[model samples]
Target chain A: MKPQSMGQAVLIGLALIYLASLYFMSSPVWMGFTINALIVAVVALAWNITGGFGGMASFGHAAMYGTGAYASAILQVQYGINPWIAFGAGIVAGAAMGAFIGALAFRYGLKGSYFALVTLAFAEVLRICASSFAITGGGSGLQLRLEPGLSTLQFNDRSVVYTILLVIVALVMALTAWLKYSRFGAYLIAVRENEDAARALGIDTYRIKVKAMAISGAFAGLAGVLYLQVWLFIDSAVVYGSAISIEALIGPIIGGAGTVWGPLIGTLGLHLLGEGAKHLLHNAPGLNFVLYAVVLICALRFLPQGLMGLAARIGTFRKKEDDNA
Target chain B: MLEVRNLSKSFGGLKAVSDASLDVPEGGIVGLLGPNGAGKTTCFTMIAGFTRPNEGTVRFMGQDVTGLPPHRICALGMIRTFQIVQPFAGLTVQENIAVGAYLHHHDRTEAMAVARQVGKRLGMGAMLDRPASSLTIAGRKRLELARALATGAKLLLLDEVMAGLIPSEVSEIVGIIRQIRDEGHTFLMIEHVMQAVMSLAETAYVLNHGKMIAHGTPKELVQDPAVVEAYLGHGAAARLQEGHHA
Candidate 1:
């Protein structure tokens, strides 16, 4: 509202863009794509806290994602609870998993590649558990009864879901933006860059890293809740699979590793490219992975900092230009 | 004031710092001079609480702070710089300083203001917004020092800050160190640059093979025969004068 910082302007711009795009697109296909983009944005923003800023690369984000999905799905399917309340339950479950994993890994001195391996192993274990557990519908999966009521988080309309998703995406963006300048964020960056240096300066690297991991997990859980509401059904393939983890991990990396708004931009652009490639490579089944690989390679080779880094540079350049005039 | 009692550290079978003890008076520069691999850095690490001493007590003020974590020690008004410059490469020069300011202030505005003030004092004000990776070696050294100073630590442990500096830059750093000391900040500095140590240090400690071989004023240290034999080449004892006044 003050119009002093770039953050406010960027946030307002993102909201406006989401709203304008919603107005322009009337088809269910467009609505589905938009929701997917928002979901990816939420996951990427969650991943950024630990993987990007904290420099703790995780390949097992599916553990949190699956836990969230299952928690909400189970609550609604068995307990006759509303999806809205079940989402909160999912967040709590995800937070618990995050804290447990973060504490164990940090306390035991597991880091870098080993830490990533631990996360990956946890995700695989979760996937196997979901496949075997009766509570989660075993290998068959559980489907929620669609109670079409405002309180049940069920709307027989795509637009209502899309609108809710837009607000969630914006909220996630604003939270990450706030974190970018917080003391905890600075501490995390310091810990990520050099743990020894950060410690020498009196920053508790372990506690900060664990906190970041927990927060990241909670956001992933939130994303899971939204995903469940949209489809009103959950299965291990849709929730606990490695594919979901890969999608969550890659979205942030492709956009920008640690910058605000990177995840959203990366998700939006990648989903659009995915759709376009489906038409262009109608027969070549492997073209999707090929396109992703090419983009990753290009991003690593030329723009290692990602599009957000480029945009920041251009923004500063424009400011200098304006000053000169 | 700072005191190290029976401080010792061993790696494998070799004792890097053995039974070393020294007391640095408050609000004055004390030089630690030793040859390479003489346990000077090992002692600094132990005192700064980066490494645990095998058998030692590091007392600051009147507190028995043995084996305290580095940040906890820093919060109690003690901070040390590494021998090698380790600036946060992805962050700007000001942001690097802001990380240090994070210990004192929570608000970004106040922390940045403090960072700018410290940057200006350290002659890094102009390059505040520049990426840390872009700075020259001497500039990185300044950023390191500025960051340490920003933590509001009462006791500063500087490890060879003048190691890779040109003559003019060394002089500038010496002036700043002197100014910082004059402002009532205590310092325990390790330096191989004899000129800066001889000029700035009020008291000097000489270490050889992880032991405090000699302790006196810089002039007295120059005349210690044992110290001369340790540093001055064989049959080059007469050239010690040239080394001292160089």
Candidate 2:
């Protein structure tokens, strides 16, 4: 990784110290939940690259996510492989799958809503495949035994999972920050704005788009690995559900699309909203989804550019004020 | 230097360019003057490699570049600006120019240098930092010229560049075009501004109904019977004749 910027170093140091405090001060359960949020944040941030910057909005991120979950689960359950190795393998598998789908969609000249439909269809296909595949435990699912060891990627202590998740989030955030200033990032933006123009400038827009999708899928896959490690179980419903894909998009949209900080804000807001809904409408099982829809609708209408855009505007406004002062 | 031979493009049954041929030598502005629906734009597009001619060859610097993509053709030192100016709206004027410069240099600093130089050349130095969408029509035209210039193109394909400019602006643009030519750049311009064409173009090609009606020096071109009949009405040519006699 490139040397962290002063701000990034400070932020990462604070995050690390915060994680250290989780071991010394916070309850293990609290750490576990916080880590869960971070994992979701990482996945959402990755998703924003393809859906937001690349302008190829997808609703099948869960397919990759679920693939990771199941790949790791089955590797541990059946092949007797180390969970760490399984995690890496799962990420690769997810990226490959993402590239496959991206190529197929692009090759068939699908774009916009049709692209979204293709992704949605892939999710459903994966879900159905998982349900019918007996080797994957089908509907019965696979649960890992919680062994207390670093090598196993399973621990009796919830704090370990929390720390792991914190590290993953930090890594994902750093990767995204690196990409923002890189040539690939600029090319992706160019491809998004105008494909023909990008092509005219000697950019292979197709390759950039596919690379973005693959990276996003790989991140989602990593998130799935952690999720499976944390919960100790991977069911077809949990891995391949369309809801997981929707959950992935909500954080990025709420945070801001295209900007690094947007997904974090989005994930935090969505999590808070979900928590509030759970507390306020605990008896009504369907109210959480309704609340999610409401928040998304409100976000789309009011904060169309997301909180990051609002923050950037405020930053520029303040900067101007400072200049005048 | 460029040569187009037997270039033909038909859209369905409508012949856009019919066996058109032109050879442009280095270091001169060759004006492509034609009435509306004369397929002047089609010929330009074919030469710029935007569209493939149904049956023809485009030799740029003596290489057959007929069916190559637009960007590859651009990379080989040929660039075109649209008749309708398309300023990348979200980008600043400097950034838009920088994209053109990026074809030659990847270093942002070097691209900025080229952008600054080209911007100053086109009288757009003050507006470089402004967003292109916010520019005036005249400013947009300058941006288009700056962008094309920044591409390091040896030959420029300009289509209707003076369509919206006032007479003063047109004259200024003509001066710039001539100055660029003096600096060793070749130009193929499609223009309806006859006075500018008459002053700036050493050679002129007139098209009518997708056929090459006349090709000669501007002096001979304006005097051609078919050219006068095509541009001026048959009666208007007579009026000119009577006015000259009087």
Candidate 2 structure lDDT: 0.80
Summarize candidate 1's per-residue lDDT along B97-165 as a digit string, tens digits.
Answer: 999998989999999999999999999988898878788889988998899989999899999999989
Residue-level lDDT of model 1, residues A224-268, one tens digit each, is 877887888778878777766777767778777887767777777
The collision pairs in model 1 are A202-B71
Q: What total of clashing residue pairs does each candidate reach?
A: 1, 2
lDDT of 2 by residue, B90-140 (tens): 567887777678777777778778888899888888788776778878888
Top model number, TM-score: 1
lDDT of 1 at A203: 92
Stretches off by above 4 angstroms in model 2 are A1-30, A70-76, A142-145, A315-325, B107-123, B228-246
Report the number of the highest-DockQ candidate.
Answer: 1
